[model samples]
Target: MNKDDAELARFNALARDFWDPKGPMKPLHMLNPLRIDWIENQYGSLVDAEVLDIGCGGGLAAEAMAARGAVVTGLDGADKLLKAAQLHADDHQIQVDYQLGMAEDWAAANPGRYELVTCLEMLEHVPDPESVIAAISHALAPGGTAVLSTLNRTARGFLLGIVAAEYLLKWVEPGTHTYRKFIKPSELAEMCRRHGLEIKAVTGVRLNPLRALQPQPFELTQNDLAVNYFMSVRKPL
Candidate 1:
């Protein structure tokens, strides 16, 4: 499999409790609203937009986008995660097309298909993130937008994003991330530009230390890209 077995195993194990607010995926639950807000602000309203979510994972962002009236299709490599996503969506009566597949395949099969593409907290998991970036670019229609998020490769990113969150605080599975695969903003920007996607904005996701243990500790900001950050890009018409 081109996918990371360890990371996929960890996510598959969480399928049962994926939607639990206080479960292992709490960080995602907490960050989804902020992610949605930033995406909406960057791409404007998602109503009727043909949106594709790469590495959607248990439908966290996909379901949220569907709720906002987007015609959403979520793609992930994990079967259990996709099943969980579908069940959750069915339970909530939220319509979303959750498929177990690779972004590269989807992009190749349907070129210039989606108006918006979202791939959050996923770039660092794959061996060839550049390929994924190219796939994202290819999947977008002209004048479409793509919003992506990932951890920066830096000392602070390693300390807080990996050590603190995974080991010390036990916020997520210890092997959930690999430091070497983490992408720096410059690298990601270069990838986007090389794939012919124009960068619109790169925003940081800041966490207040004092409220680190709280349910909602993250907020988007113009500065502080030492850790997690989001980039919005557009395809030229």
Candidate 2:
């Protein structure tokens, strides 16, 4: 049962210091607030909403959502990462159910469980992303919201996400990504549609490379989505 074993191993190997802001996961730490802000602006404050954070490596987004009053569950397929998430949540007194298992399998066993489903920077790493999307649809309650972010399959994506981030800047480990796995916005919209999710907004996620170094905020935009992008989807009532 290898649902992307390489990816699981990759994150597992980096799990110990996943919550450290100065570690390999620092990029995610910087990107998380922007993700949370966009979610709040689009989905409204999650007070009392049932939320699921898929591929929730170290509880960054999960804790943020819990802070906004959402009853949250953080799911990851890797054991080490799940432990890191649990420890981080415990240290902050954040109440998030940290679970370790495949998202597809977990969603199969827990259908219609969440009012909001978030899969961020994760779809690209899976061997069959459509399976993950279908699983998320099952996990989401009818009329729930699904927000996903991933690398775009574009020239700029190859240059920036791969060339610049992994190689030149060394912000991420070498061979952390493959260009073929990146998803285009159009492809993602179609995949969501097939799973009963209506596309609402597609926004470009931009963080100045300097932010990864100097520490600063990022931006979301509809103007450009050549590298990284986020899309909000909804299950029809």
Candidate 3:
């Protein structure tokens, strides 16, 4: 199989346990509360807004956004994950549109449609990060805001995200992460700028030892390029 096929296969394999609270992804599950809080603090209330979640695996963040009163649409390239998200949403009686497609493809098909677009923990897995960013830009309304979270290319990030999380804690599957695909904050920021989005805020996300088993609130720091960073960008008004 080619690169895309291989990645999709990995995601498919993980889909069964993606939403299981006791699964390998429990660490990410634990981070849900903190992620939701950070997203709310950055975007304010999503009440009555149209929100798009790119690469929204298992609908964790998407459901959080929906709970906050936004019309949430979750998109993913993995079919099994999308199916799981749909089932989970149905089980909760919450409405979310789960689409099976790449971020760029969906964005191209529906331009200037979303008030808020979120691409979290996904850029590293894609083949063309810039194209994905461009799609995100196209999907947002002129004044829309985009929130992104991803690992950085640094010793700290590698050690924490790959070594500690994957190897030590077993938070994810083995070989699920590759250091070469990791991106730097500068590169992400530049991609956003090139796609007609202005970088509004760049904040580092920390993992507290106490809350290491669960998601804790991320403090805004001047140190944007860290182990993990959350960035808020906006298209011009």
Candidate with more favorable, higher TM-score: 1 or 2? 1
Worst 10 residues of 2 by lDDT: 208-217
TM-scores for candidates 1 onward, in order: 0.98, 0.95, 0.93
Against the reference, the lDDT scores of all candidates come to 0.93, 0.87, 0.84
lDDT of 3 by residue, 1-237 (tens): 112777778888888888887686676677677677777777789898899999898899999889889999999888998898899889999899998887777887999999999988888887778888999999999989999988899998899889988889887888787888888999999999998999988878777667555444244466546788888999998
lDDT over C-alpha atoms for residue 26 of model 3: 78
Winning model by lDDT? 1
Ranking by TM-score: 1, 2, 3
Per-residue lDDT of 71-123 in model 1, one digit per residue for the tens?
99999998999999999999999999988898999999999999999999999
Candidate 2 off by > 4 Å: 209-213
Total residue pair clashes for candidate 3: 2
Cα-based lDDT at residue 158, candidate 3: 90
TM-score, cand. 2 vs. native: 0.95
Model 1 error, position 142 (Å):
0.5
Model 3 residue 144 lDDT score: 90
Give the alpha carbon lDDT tens digit for every residue of 1-237 in model 2: 526888889989998888888788767887888889998877888999899999888788999999899999999888998898888888888899999878888898999988899999989988989888999999999888999999999999999899988888777888889999999999999999998899989999876656556675467778889989989999888
Top TM-score model: 1
Indicate the worst ten consecutive residues by lDDT in candidate 1: 1-10
